[model samples]
Target: MRTSRARFWAAVALAAATVPSGLACIWDGDTLAAEVRHRGYLVLDALTGRFDRLPPEYYRKRYELASERIAKDPSALAAYDNAAVACERLGRTDEAIDWMLKKQAAMEALPVHDRAARDDARYRFHANIGTFYAHRWVAGGAKRDDPDALAALDHLTKCMAINPEAHFGREVVQLGMIEWLNSERKQSLGDHLAERVMSSVPYAMDSSNNVLAEGLAGLVLLGAAWESVDVYNCMAHTLNFSFDSSLSFVAALRVEELLQSGKRPLDQSEGWRITLDDAASFWEDQYKKRYRTELTKVYSQLRAAGDEYVRKRNEYVLARLAEGRHPDSDGGFWSDWTEPARVELPDRRALTRSQFALVQTLLAGGILAGVVILILVASRVSRSRKRAR
Candidate 1:
């Protein structure tokens, strides 16, 4: 590290001192201040902590350094951005928001002649707000009704509208909206909305610092299609078991048609369509084969309980009818099957526990293998370096 730092500083000095025809200092005061501020940031981080964890002092120093840089270079966009991110990383949500808002305010204060700069700044403002809202939503204190979740969606939408192909922001916003919709129990609406958003995804779209738009668009479309299948599956399961109405055949046919379709939408996302077909096939196979046992059990249990309730209801009605009174409007069987209707909903947690356990075991094993491989590779690299020296 010392050797590398010495060499880096040597290069920096050479660049700073060199001039073709006595041109003034290459790095002006603002640039020098920016360089010093970056070094201070590195030193602050070292003094505070290491990767994956940071003491409050680390963040405090980082924020102070960035703030100083912003003060020196009032148009320093990165300084404000870094300060805002550092504040968020330090768990200072309000401070982060304030810094970001100030960054936007400063950019807006710039002259109207700089229209392009203003536009860029406006995009950043909406994008950062969208990012913050998404983080808050995932952090889970905010419920479905939380205005922050809505605000996040709104910000992201605005960002995309400002620059319709902001692949990165659009992807995050779409995912956030999907999650928010799921949390709000508006799964159907989410599915349809996701479908629309995905349909408009640019094929070669590349987000800054990432190649995610195409891949994520594929995933979102596939997920929405499968979600549609799941909705029908659930409906079929409910009707088949609860009401003795057979909708599985119809649902299966619809899912099959979707899987088999070679229409424009499906052709547009062939990569995703293949995976979607696999899921649909899996569900359809379950319906054709495995569904019988589960549906049979559920139906038998429900039907038996329902029959008992009906029997008691009929008995009560007949007894009433036999009495010197009519069993019509006043003595209907509506009051009879209350007990069966009150049966608790199946506990999804309990139902999924075994599957969750299996997934956890697989994940733990995979992580352990990864750690061992990383250690071996690191050791091999260390030995190679030593030999080279």
Candidate 2:
């Protein structure tokens, strides 16, 4: 099925031309949160230093144990959270929201005297609810009046007061997402949010990241709408003007390797999915012709930065693919996570930094040996000449 090339490039032009207008800034408050976007691992990486996340079965057993704890004591707050995580992992997002709400009500009903001491708990509850509601809103078709939007905003607003100094408006990306969806991808939202979005955009994934921002950045660039040539073109513009150099692109690329090859964020759910046989093929052809060299340059620079940098890039790539984003087994370099082994790319050095150093050491040693041999030969020749004299 041939796609309308004219419609596709138009969206591409539009997406590329519009810039985020908000006064958003890179959030430096949470160091751990920053790395999550680049590597795609959180609790698992933090605890085991492994690049893997817990499997679905792990969530299942966790839910069972947490439920048993809850039955014995309804006030087992963490247990409610545990169960909610399990539900989310099982694709039961609404259920996850329910668990968080239950947790919220339980917190609300606490004695006023006890509430002061529970600010920490309240903060956690609001963040979790905001995430769940925003997620639900997306899954619910990203409608303008989705109750989830207001619910997310209500909870996130409550977040502003709990720790006024430390919170850092971490919801910047999440809120932009809600607003963007509500506006139906129009320029009006950008005009409204431009400053706010710019103030918090993470120029780099590892050092200054809001996974939410990083995640949403990728989300806006790609989604289920890509089959429309317009959407496909819009998605493939990895450096879509909205994000530009202040930050760059990928999750969609991995989603795109399923896409025509680009990435989106969050690493979950069918509502956010994109798959099209002809559209993907068309984008693939267009990408190879127009974007591959550019992507290769960005990708190569990161690879050259050293193993740690490459590791983070690989993690983001692998995490997106692992979520079942790829339509085919061949997801290129992103098909599997690289660990001690790094995948090679254009201009990627064949040696690690340490390996490069070792090579330099050996070459220097060889040169020194040659110099010594020349000196010895010169001295012997001089001695022979003297004896002849």
Highest lDDT against the true fold, candidate = 2
Top candidate (TM-score): 2
lDDT for predicted candidate 2 compared with the true structure:
0.45
For model 2, the superposed segments whose C-alpha errors exceed 4 Å read 1-54, 109-117, 160-170, 188-194, 199-258, 261-389
TM-score of 1: 0.37
List candidate 1 segments past 4 Å from native.
1-62, 167-179, 186-193, 202-389
TM-scores for all candidates: the values are 0.37, 0.47
RMSD of each: 26.0, 20.1
lDDT of 1 by residue, 60-178 (tens): 55567688888898777756766776676676666777877888778766767777766766666776666576566646765775777777777766776676554322444354444
Clashes of 2: 33
